[model samples]
Target: MADIFSPSRLGGTSQAVALASACLSILLVLYLMFFADLYRRPDATESQVAQTLEGRPPLDIHIEMMSLDPIRQTVEARLNFPERRADAAQAGGARVRLSDGGFVRELHLPADRAAGATSVEFGLDGSISAYPFDVYRTDALIAAFAGEGAQEAPLAVQLTVWERLPAWEARVVSRPARPGEVGLPISIEARRPPAHVVFALIVYAVMAVIAVCGLAIGVLAACGVRKIEAAFASSLAGMLFAAPMLRNAMPGAPPLGVAADAYVFLWVQVALMIGLVLFICAWARRGSPP
Candidate 1:
């Protein structure tokens, strides 16, 4: 047994060490992934505001976030106008207009059960300059209308303020109807999840490595510090195309020319292209080898 563990069989020991290291790395990665997922997971998938609306209601709006569209930059909201009370319209009105983000939406009081729920969309107004890190704000104002103009009413707002977006998380705030607004003004601020932000940073890091490699190759080849190979140009070309794919791989990547594109993806592409050109020039400059 001692002989089996002797220096003469160090290869086995090295292999065992390598295997253990690999296993340890995998375990660490899994642990991190799970921790990240748990940390980024929405505290509650659905924020049921059951108790929010108690009384003081002739009309109440159940505003549910249906989904978010990063591409179109819109938020889908489902308003359940349950047939409950129109007499609560305070000013003796059977109609209410929801003014949100400068758009006016009206739902008939004591909504017709046959008509079901009313759907409204609000534009996500924010800068997508820093994608994955971009934050958006959307709000709504409610008022009861006797005929045309909206009137203030004591509105009980029940907010179901949590929704798990594909990459973003919505944090909704229910602000009670102030002076002019009727029901309540719901303000939603959505941003990418922590895990997603971390993932995007990792992607940027990988892209940085690629860019550095390109710069190194280009500088080295231009300086004639290393023997240049024709294959290097092809490798650069491949990376030039593949780098965009890596950018697109982001959980919910925005269009080209985003902040990341300006900082990482675009630069990485430039690096590879420059490297390819340098390598090609060097390859051509060098005469036939012996």
Candidate 2:
């Protein structure tokens, strides 16, 4: 490793390091973002099939997010109703949660079947606050209806579920119009990640580039001077600029006094790792005698 760090080997080593760094960063980001089913159970049924309520339906139903922490016996959710009307008309109102018995049931159901049957309490029964599915229109009498007393708000009434531990993804399977077939139709789809994912990725990429460039430039500026201490200080300062990003990537680290988009935390790590490499290269350039 020392030999690889030598100026004589810097060119090849730098390229190799950069490439390895990029790949590792990408893999790390993907592992964090897509690999661990931390938020949802792996192989859990993601799609649901209901008897086709076909009519070019004005709205669509979807599960937004489901989190289960059994020790706490807690579940969190956000369901989606993709379309709503200018009027109070919307789609859906309830969902069923399935238990180990494979019986469909309401969320947070009571221990007594009769009580739960009457109240249907499995997790929060109604729509999640702060992310209501209703779309408020802003024209004429329609807009006026939204002035505080709209009762027919939009909601999602269906749910797709599977065992929490099974390695099987659930889909809403339905009986075919024919006499004996049952299967999920190709038209059914799981909920798509919101547009925010794309937006966050782009923003993070751009920020990473800027941070990397700043780190490289900081090192380069310090190299102009012959003082080793000054150059080291400059490099340290560069890394400090990236400290917030690093803290987020590290598990259990507190937020580093910076507000960041939670979704971009993965890419922020990639950028910081890349920036570290460029700084190392710049420091190598400075170490050479005039």
Candidate 3:
């Protein structure tokens, strides 16, 4: 049995099996990479739009969320009405009213594609204390004017939040329409994609390794097991500065005091500082040869 488990005896077979397994894993990952998207399919977004527009109203304000600024708590969106462009022009162009509590705003969605899409910004109220795991929720009402009143329009009630979000994913849910509700009530929840969360974890792991290695070097020096050099000490000091740059490299990193800062950034910095101090103390005492 020991002979069967010997490294040299099993090397040929094990190398072939391991290589085949690695190749298969790489191919599978590549396949997924080709098709994976952080946003919903365009077909899916339009399908939902078609369903929501059915029998609702004559005018529709097709709202597509374009990008999100998590740090600023704002979402950028585009509004268009191609299907009702002709209708809107016949009825003095499509105009919509949006109400969020006491504040109300009017939006003019052009019917002509050449006229370009109307860009609007919505404020996000969700707290980002959780960072890469944060979710933002907001909603607005849609209503159109009719007859001679020149009423407001959020027409078409089609809200899509599945595009141009390379780092975030959002879900649009229908809010309970109040009896006196003047427009379409929509609620959106946006969260970081799995890639972001995975990246955050990887950052945490990398920070941990950096801190630990620094501590290991310091500890060895302080314990008199390893010689401390001036160049090595300077490198450790340089790392103290490099740590912040690494922390800021996170995708769409927020300002300081976020959970990620508390999780690994702070601790890593502290560890590195302590390690640098240890090395300095060791150098002072032993005075390793130049």
Per-prediction tally of clashes: 2, 8, 11
Q: Please provide, for model 2 over 1-290, each residue's C-alpha lDDT reduced to its tens digit, 9 standing for 90 to 100.
A: 89968887998878899999999999789768753544564445455544333342222334433433222322333433333322223223322233311123433211122112122112322221111121111100000111123552222233343323211111223323433322122111122132323343444566666556555554554455333333654654555466455444432223333234344444555555554555556556665555
The alpha-carbon lDDT assigned to residue 56 of candidate 1 equals 49
Estimate, for each residue in 176-211, the C-alpha lDDT of model 3 and write its tens digit.
877888656776667887677767767777888888
Per-residue lDDT over 132-159 for candidate 1, one digit per residue giving the tens place of the 0 to 100 score: 7888877766554333344533445444
RMSD versus native structure for model 3: 6.5
Model 1 spans > 4 angstroms off: 1-37, 40-42, 48-55, 58-60, 70-72, 83-93, 110-115, 144-162, 176-179, 287-290
Worst 10 residues of 2 by lDDT: 136-145
TM-score of each: 0.74, 0.28, 0.72
List per-candidate RMSD values in Å.
5.7, 17.0, 6.5
- lDDT scores of the candidates, listed in order: 0.70, 0.37, 0.71
Alpha-carbon runs more than 4 Å astray in model 3: 1-47, 50-57, 83-94, 108-116, 150-162, 229-231
Tell me the deviation in Å of residue 19 in model 3: 21
Return the candidate ranking by TM-score, descending: 1, 3, 2
